[model samples]
Target: MTLQQAPETVRVTAAVEERMVTPSLSVQGVVSGAPTREVRFEGSAGGAKQIVTSVAVAQDASIAFGDLLATVSGVPVFLLPEGVPLYRDLRHGDSGPDVSAFQSLLTRLGYLRGSATGTVDARTLTATGLWYKAYGQKLPESEGKPYVAVDHFAAATGEGTVRLGPTVGQRLEPGKPLFVLSAGQQAVTARFTVPEADAVKVGTAVTVRASGGASFAGTIASIGPFQSNEASKEQRAGHDVRVELSLQDAAAPKEASTVSVTVGGQGRRGPAVPLSAIRQGSQGTYVTRELEGENSSGTPPTRDVTVAVLAQEGGWASIETNPELPPGAKVIVG
Candidate 1:
């Protein structure tokens, strides 16, 4: 009689006893700077066409408080702290947040003493005159009274560099943006499918990889509403959600560039198995676990254990079984 042949042994991989598994979705993204506000010309040209006389800073130059932005028709345009637009001219005895913010600027420059009282007092006027003098400009005057003119300074929020919009010899229009102030911080923007949006949220950690193999840690700063593109014969309509990521302790690409972003979903700690090992059957999701001893047929014994998939990531799946699958358990993957 011929000897009975051993049954074929199936391929298997060890199930991770316990670990945190988090699913990650990769999507294309773009790097950009955070824009705070657009600096606009708020001065009335007094019926005369406002013309850019000279440019003090170049395009993409770093500007700060007390920095001259441009010269318009022989009047210097200085950059100042963000506040209510200097609608009307400010002079001694004017009291408001605008006046207070200006006074604070003067104090910071050592042109004014003590805290800003929100009132343009004698000291405030003196400081203003000194500030203009320091920049080689005469204090603007109307009716023989020295005052801060609306056209002399532009309001910019945040502390960062600015991008000049107006060039020398360009006509300046009141209420038109002259420059854009950026917060000097870099951020990444990307869109995710609607299904993936449910797993991603604000403050979710992500990995950003730029061209040339550079990578950085980032966090989800904001989530936008769902958007859909109009469907056409060539392409099917789809919905997606937008997300912005703030780079942490790293400089992003200077110019706008394409990047790859990997966003991780919430993690769960539990027993896990190779994603390939998970199978769906009549009883539901389950995995085939190999037994320790061989069966009477001389083949390895195995049984299917029903499991609830909690999370999956990186080729592994976290699962829950009735009888907890212990660490180092062998599971059939092939």
Candidate 2:
């Protein structure tokens, strides 16, 4: 209808079915792991690869391995003891791919000047020896025997030679590493090193938030094995603790994003309301209540209402309308 050409009214009536109106808060936060873990591995050219350091378990406030050790380049990151570390059975086949993997690591670490194609070349082996010698690690000889840890990589010739230990400019052999290098060089942990001043008792409860607005309601299937406050939900940091939280259904996160964590905080129950819907009177605050609206079943109606002003924030107010109010009650806003 046009503003000036309004039609006469026809009265219509409907029923008001009582329904429950639940409200919640939408909090913005970053997710993180409350606990994490790591494992390390060792391998040589013609020897059985072993997990020398094994799985390093840190918990309760211990430092994680990722925060301490670095990974060897050109190797696949692996979770060992069950899953196979990358490049396992390399001794049985042509060494091309293996050489490529090694070269790939070398290229990443600024050691090799060629493409990461697995070919056992003279320069590659020499670079490999240089890497170990530089890092002060032990390496098997050309025949893959035991090992002599290299001390330094420079001779008195000033710039013409690269030493392989106490030996002056020992030449590197093909298909053999002068020093040991493996991708699974070390394992990492996901725990944070809590300060002694802030560290809680062993069984103290801690609250953790999830990344990208995850949830914490419903049945908690499990708690974390360790503790840390350093994990970021954005996955930006190189190392952080990870906590696994499972839910009964996928939809619980829709209700609320951040759960009010109660480590040792007092817990209580209170009525929640919108900040705008509330208003202050001489005695207290009040909210506006509508006498009519539509129901979830898709029928509109009206009923008696007493609006209680609970809270106010931003442009909105949390008001408590009549509990008997229908799902979609219309109210006059100020």
- The models' CA-based lDDT, in order, is 0.72, 0.33
What local lDDT score does residue 286 receive in model 2, on the 0 to 100 scale?
A: 40
Residue-wise lDDT of candidate 2 within 1-334, one digit each (tens)?
A: 6568669554332222222222222222223322212232233344433222311222222221112122222222222221211343322123555456555655655667877555555666666556555544433453663322111110110111111111123333333322221111111113322211112233333443444444353211223333333565543222122222333223323322333322222322233333333434344334344444567744544333444433222333333435644445343333
Expressed as tens digits, the lDDT of each residue in 1-334 for candidate 1 is: 8999889765656765688888777877778766666876666556877788888776556777788888887889988766644566888788898887777778887899899798878888888888888877888888899988877887766556555467778987656787876664567767664334444667777888888888877777777765555544533222233335454233556547988888766788878888788776567567898888889977678889887776667777777744646778888886
For each candidate in turn, the TM-score is 0.57, 0.30
lDDT of 2: 0.33
Best by TM-score: 1
Q: Report how far residue 172 has shifted in candidate 1, in Å.
A: 1.8
Clashes of each: 1, 21
lDDT at 133 for candidate 1?
A: 86
Worst 10 residues of 2 by lDDT: 154-163
